[model samples]
Target: MTDRREWPLYEVFVRGKRGLNHVHVGSLHAADSTMALRNARDVYTRRNEGVSIWVVPAAAITASSPDEKDPLFGPSADKVYRHPTFYPIPDDVPHM
Candidate 1:
């Protein structure tokens, strides 16, 4: 049996039938991508709540740190044109 410590960590994402995008569910350890996918399906969708599954190696993911939030995302805050507040919402528009 392979030692648990040697297994690579995987991040699992699942998309439900009604959901338009995949959401992060949890993490697990697996020996390979195939195993990781299978494990994610069994672990996350036992009740068949999900229509799709995605397993990504934890090592392959690059994430921004909270400390770098200002430097990374602050620039976008100044771009007021990016927001749709200037547009008038018609009374006929539903859910606007």
Candidate 2:
């Protein structure tokens, strides 16, 4: 008899601060959420570069296909309101 346990895939993300975006570290396997966190610490935190960690199942990731990348995202390019270029930066503003 064989012990047939399937490991759930996880997507690991780490961030150094609230201002920084979480970056994908690598993938690992765990039996449960607790184990997933511990495994992430063991793998991604070894460098002491991250202040936070997040693990999400890879299967849960719904992403647009690369083949549709242009059609999916290109429309947003015309939405100038998303960019701050319309506003004249005040001299008082530190970072524009």
Candidate 3:
């Protein structure tokens, strides 16, 4: 016997009108990719809050473990020059 719980799980991302990037919203289980997208829209955007939606199979995502954050991000921490703090913006720049 097959359990419905075995249905593929999908991760949902929503881009709100005010947001510049898509943000993780929630997860849902569906039989296929098309259904997953429709289900994500119906479930996560009930209030019409999102301008865009993305649905990816949970199994397709490769994520770093939370416990390994320091190890994963440590190299970038010492590269202070990577940040634009030293750059002087012209007054003409609107969003800087």
Question: Would you estimate the TM-scores of all the predictions?
Answer: 0.79, 0.72, 0.74
* Alpha-carbon deviation at 9 in model 3, angstroms: 0.7
Task: Estimate, for each residue in 1-96, the C-alpha lDDT of model 2 and write its tens digit.
Answer: 998888898889888665378899888888877889889999998878789889998888998899998988989988989887888888999986
Error of 2 at 58 (Å): 0.8
Instruction: Give the better candidate number (1 or 3) by TM-score.
Output: 1
Local distance difference test, per candidate?
0.93, 0.86, 0.93
Candidate 3 ranges beyond 4 A from true positions: 1-5, 18-20
Better of 1 and 2 by TM-score: 1
In angstroms, how far off is 90's CA in candidate 2? 3.5
Question: Between which residue pairs do clashes occur in model 2?
Answer: none
Q: What residue runs in model 1 are displaced by over 4 Å at the alpha carbon? A: 1-4, 75-82
- Count of clashing residue pairs in every prediction: 0, 0, 0
Question: For model 2, how big is the CA root-mean-square deviation?
Answer: 2.8
RMSD of candidate 3 to true structure, Å:
2.6
> What lDDT does candidate 3 reach at residue 48?
83
